[model samples]
Target chain A: MVDIPILMIGKNVVVPIQTELNDIGAKKMQEDVLYKIEKTTASGLVIDVSAVSIIDSFLGRILVDTSKMAKLMGTESVIVGMKKEVVLTLIQLGLRMENLNTALNLEDGLNLLRKLQETLHGKISG
Target chain B: MEKYQDSRDSGQGQSVSTTIFVASYEDVIVARQKVRELMNEMKFSLLDQTRVVTAVSELSRNIIVHAGKGEMTIIKYDESGRRGFRCIFEDKGPGIADIDLAMREGYSTTNSLGLGLSGSKKLCKNFSIQSTRGKGTRIEIAEWK
Candidate 1:
């Protein structure tokens, strides 16, 4: 099954990938997240994957796709709490997923989002 | 691509290696769960456990999508003072012709940009593939601790 939880954290959307998600589940997640991002006008998306044990290249691609969708909708996507083994496997798979930003944990992700927002605001006359 | 030392000989007489049928998606999930349990009992780190589980998922899925129906075995191995788990996937489906080509990165038979074979090889410490034109394919992967 591909069920995961998406919650609101201030103006951000926090997605916790607590289990192995199949392709169907991830596609649904992308739709739900994009809808919420537009409706709430959120500024950041932090995907917590500390609990995820297995991630295939296909799932890795979906994460990159979600980040692209969020970026287009004015939300910065940040993946947080990736396990060390997961990182090693991802590298071994030779799939350097483009446009996906990551942090150490949820707290770090939030800080990163805030800093990016501040920079955007400071640079864009808003 | 590379096959290393096998520790199966030390298993007294017979090991209760589990054979899983891969005729549908449900079987893949069952195999993943079983592999996770074996890894957990072996006290593999979360990352190592996940790596093996991910490889299992990929191989099992390939059996279903590429081949019609196949089987896999999960057995615990202890070779050369290293203890870990090994998974063997076998299919009687149409086998791969060019192993060298299949092992290349960025190559796919179907359009999902399928990571296909090479990715799985990279995820494990020991990997080997044997295939015949119309006979079948056998893939073995092992990670030692």
Candidate 2:
């Protein structure tokens, strides 16, 4: 199985899904992301899915679960770069990702992560 | 990969068809890619292609997750000026006992989101399912261009 690379910048980690991942691969990715977050103490996580063409129910669940798990680990997560068609399909599939945060692109995802980090820090400091 | 096979039958004014055996998660990806390529070659819109491919992924995965093994048949049809693609998924697993409950969204016996059947129905233009306890299950879905 191919391992999805997780890049660390500052206090955040960016995981760009570059190919079609099978079920095992996706689950592994989730585990890897969580491990990296814990290992690096990342305050923010960005999952870029621009290269992913399909986001079926299983993949959708993995994303939601990953974000929720990250939240429990004290890391904020944002999903980014979803194609228009993928968005439409995910909605039609009735997979409501209510707890997940999303952005339009990588830059926007990073910015959102930064904002989330600030709010979190503010709450702790103030 | 021993069970993998491909045979296309096309005749004058006849629908073209291809069958794929799905037994693992890798087969699910292959099935989705096959449907996407076929839809693209048929000039389907980008949105339609994505929707159909997503549905294919769900159904094929269902076959592996629920039945352990199954086959997917994709057919290209042009009937009376209406052109479309039809996908049939057949599995001989332990068959669903309650079709109604199984069709209900958010109701799953395997701890999944329970969107496989219901969501696939919404994605296609035409959808149908047949199953018998102790027998097997078959699902057919079609999308017109």
Candidate 3:
């Protein structure tokens, strides 16, 4: 369990979580994303959790909170690469992840971000 | 909650199960991995394993948020012929004052989405919980494959 890396791609900040995220790590991720959103001036944030092995309610809320904060800061956030079983489980846990945007995979998420950018400003820069 | 703890093994002779404590954020991850391995050993599909592990994550986290300390037990069950897994989460902290209110979606005592209890129940085939305000809380969920 090393640190979950957050990268910047095009006009988006991408966080590809490859391992399980604990409470401390989840909070750190939220803070890092918020700080980077301001520094990169990215229009969108994409989080790929395909490789993640687990997600609890606390981390679930942190994710939702992060996306909401990102939205408030003028950045759209998309979470992608969720497993089918995970989705079913998440639904049961009452965290629809509904409050946050989502995609089927990384490419779709990036594309979605592009479309969102165009729709938001009537321009395609990403 | 004791209803799921049937003494009868159904067929596999003596049953085998392991219990792990959940006290901190790190312990939450450990509980998840333990469940993941147990599910995998049971030959669960990738989706099934993920679903159960996700359930473990939410419930173990509940121990930390609500009780500040707790433990989880992973058990393998053989019923009338089907095979699956069972997990029990127990906490000694304050019990939920309202079970119905806690089960509702979007309900939260700590600004959370209020999904841990209700949501964990959804991921498995069977779910049950028992609690007394001054005592502790115990939750049990079972899935057959």
Shift in Å, residue B88, candidate 3:
1.8
How many backbone collisions does model 3 have?
Answer: 2
Q: Estimate each model's TM-score.
A: 0.84, 0.95, 0.85
Error of 1 at A13 (Å): 1.5
Model 2 per-residue lDDT tens digits across residues B1-145: 3233334345445576788999999999999889999888889999999998999998999999989999998877765676887899999999999999999998898999999989988998889999999889999998886
Query: What is the lDDT, from 0 to 100, of the residue A74 in candidate 3?
Result: 94
lDDT of 2 by residue, A1-126 (tens): 788999997889999999999999999999999999999999999999999999999999999999999999999999999999999999999999997999999999999988988898899999
Over 4 Å off, model 1: B1-12, B77-85, B143-145
Candidate 3 residue runs with Cα over 4 Å from true position? A123-126, B1-12, B78-82
> TM-score: which is higher, 1 or 3?
3
What TM-score does structure 3 among the candidates reach?
A: 0.85
Give one digit per residue, the lDDT tens place, for model 1 in B44-82: 888777777888888888888879789888777544576
Model 2's chain A TM-score stands at 0.97
- Inter-residue clash pairs, candidate 1: none
Q: Look at candidate 1 and tell me the lDDT of residue A82.
A: 81
> Which runs in model 2 stand beyond 4 Å of their true positions?
B1-12
Per-residue lDDT for B28 in model 3?
86
The lDDT values for all models are: 0.82, 0.91, 0.81
Q: Is 1 or 2 the stronger prediction by TM-score?
A: 2
Error of 1 at B121 (Å): 1.2
lDDT, residue B11, model 2: 45
